[model samples]
Target chain A: MTISVLVVDDSPIARKMIRKALPADWDISIQEAGDGDEALAIYRSGGIDVIFLDLTMPRMDGFTLLEKLQQDDLNCFVIVVSADVQPGARERAMKLGAIEFVPKPIDPQALREVLREYGVMV
Target chain B: MSELLLNDDQTAALQEIANIGMGQAGNSLARIWGEFVALSVPRIATVAAARLPELIQRCVGDGRVSAARLLFHGAMRGEALVVISAADRRTLGSLMGFPAPAGDGDPGAQLLHIAETLAGACLGGIARQFEATIGFGAPALIGEDLPARAVVRADTLGVDLALCLEVRFRVEARSLAAHLVMLMPRQEVQGLAVLLDRFLCTL
Candidate 1:
């Protein structure tokens, strides 16, 4: 079985980093979204099992995206990859139903652990 | 430094917020470059609106510098900037995988992209500390000679008191360094102080 992942961020560099950090051995199909609008479109189309989201994007931000996901009852696991790592960031993301909060520059080991814990690895 | 604009508690709270924000920014940049980057503990101050220009001058000195700035408004209005020595432009460009400009000309486009991304990330991180909603305009370039005035007048109208936070960045095993400066309006500072006090009460 293949796991579908959506990586969303405005910066090309950041999106690239997140993609690079994914576990090589996993049967994962990756898709990219430069902003929340695009991410939402793809997400609404279904088949996304996990989302790597960034908070401060151009059009739609990660916070709004999280809210939308919850409103529509999307059951995918979300891991927030953001530079806005303030005191309340983790709590806020958790409140929005994110399974993990990883501050950027993305750490591969951390990414791997989160994937494993979430059962994203086959 | 003169009269102590913020008391010890306020200053400490702001510094802690800055530290968290900068640490997140450093981690983001490190991920992009696939390397570790270190960030300094941010130095924060609340200064009278009148003293802003002089304070900026002292920080930059008489060096050839360039800045990328973003103006934000909402619960509080202010700007965030990343300033770097002009000579370091090439190094930054190289680090980000942008080829050097033809000859020794300006560092355009690519540098602006980096600046905007970092500014949004760092400032957004800081604003979240107070649970304030801040909106940022597009990033604009401000030459060394003009950064102080540009920062002070980021709003559409006249000047206002400001909170300044300066954090330095040093990339691992690289000769590049940059300063991230955030200027928050006085009203925002007061609101943040109230929020911090309330936060302490909860603690």
Candidate 2:
């Protein structure tokens, strides 16, 4: 089975960058969402194994989405992506049940490490 | 009346801080645009609120000017204004591989958004250096005709010293130009300078 991943961000460019950074031969099926509401809708449809979420977005931020997902007991790995690398942002993401926090301008090597640790890639 | 002026040391320190912040902002922009960005050494200047219009006109010269206003509040309080020329905007967009849109309203909005984002990144870098929380308000776009005096209020915000940096950057191998003006209350500037000096001494 292909590893299904959902990428959530308000910026089309940011999403594009993240998509480009992912390994080409990772057997991954990619999905996209512009905000938290769209992400929730896609999550409910099932078959999603991992989520790459952006912190600053309109119509529902990453933290709210993570909270809702946890409250509802939805089973999916979550990775936060944000431009604001303030002191508490990463810590807050971890506390909210995020598997990892990826700083923006996405680094391909960092993505690979996170994917490997999550068992999404070998 | 002559405007209040900073001495040589104060000016140098302020310029150094601005340069560091601009460098960080350039790095952030490069990351967002998915390309390398290089910035020229920043030029520093200071002007009183009353003389701002003439200063802007002289600074911009014959080039077309676009101004965006953002308010930053935290340990350091004031406005962070970004002004870029039309030619520079095209250069920046090209370097980032983003096509300049044709429509008037859309282009204006996009340019203003970019200015706001740049101001946020630059000011955010400065805030990080100072170990402070910075909040940004919405950006307002202004025309060349608008008086700079009207754009910034002197009494309402309680700014002590206004620090401005003229910045130039190249993206995608094209030169782009802009300015970053940060207004800080006098007390904050003195306090911050002392703290930074102490920190540097310890280092």
Candidate 3:
């Protein structure tokens, strides 16, 4: 089965960085969303297997998206990729049902490890 | 700033949080400029709201500065002000693909855009740490003048504690020093200080 991933962030540069950091070896279909609203639309189409989410955005934020995901019981692994590295941020993202939290500027090694831990990569 | 409001532990905790926030802010700039951005160790200060203007002057010194002032609202409410000297403003403008002096349109507007971008980057990073969302008001440009003077003219929000930091940002051969001043109500700051201490204790 081909894995599908969604990279959601307001910054085009950041979204591109996230996409670049993905494991190049995987059979992955990557997607992009600039905000939570767009992300929701993409997510509802049901091809995404993993989501890389960002917290701060203009039209609907990651938090609200997480809430909606929980309410709707969407079964997809979520990894928050954001610049908000404050202590509580990680905790909040975890509490909101994210499987993992990655602080940004997209560390490729970190991304690999997270993907491996979740068995998204062998 | 009569009494030292934050104790040693609290001060250290706040400093750590500020460092994380600044680091994220630096990363944001690095992406924008496509160069490594150097962020200095931030010096955090807790001052009375009434004394904030005085404190700004002391740090800003005699030179006129262009400040971008954006008010933030969330679990805490206040303002985030980024101040840069006029000399640095021209340098940064040119770096951002604008002509030096950025004269195509209102120079103040151009500077204000930079200010808002930088300030948003910094505060957005900080707010994530608190697990809170901070909404920024439309950014207003405070032209070449003392930050305090511009803030006084533009804002009427009652601020009680100002968390001030002197952060130096460098990109390649060019460097710009700017101030990130977060104005919070006394009660809100105290609450944050307490929260920081608790977070540290857990660590």
Q: What overall lDDT goes with each candidate model? A: 0.71, 0.67, 0.70
Give the winner by lDDT: 1
Task: Report the lDDT tens digits of candidate 1 across residue range B2-39.
Answer: 55546776676666556556767765676555545555
How would you encode candidate 2's per-residue C-alpha lDDT over B39-77 as one tens digit per residue? 444555655554555555565555566677777777556
Better of 1 and 3 by TM-score: 3
RMSD of each: 15.6, 16.9, 15.2
Listed models, DockQ each: 0.06, 0.01, 0.04
Docking quality band of candidate 1, CAPRI definitions: incorrect
Candidate 1 vs candidate 2, DockQ winner: 1
Worst 10 residues of 3 chain B by lDDT: B146-155
Residue-wise C-alpha lDDT for candidate 1, range A17-94, written one tens digit per residue: 677788778888999998889999999999999999987665787888999999999689999987655535567778
Instruction: Write one digit per residue (lDDT tens) for candidate 3, span B1-203.
Output: 25665776766655555655776777666655555664555566777666666666665555667787788777556777777766666666555665544254356766667667767777776666667777888988755655444544323545555556555555545656666676665656777776666655644
Measured by TM-score, the strongest candidate is 3
Residue-level error in angstroms, candidate 2, position B130: 1.4
* lDDT at A118, model 2: 84
Candidate 1 wrong stretches, greater than 4 Å? A1-122, B1-5, B104-106, B144-157
Backbone clashes per model, in order?
5, 2, 1
lDDT of 2 by residue, A29-113 (tens): 9999998999999999998999999876667878789888988786989998766454355777788899998876568899899
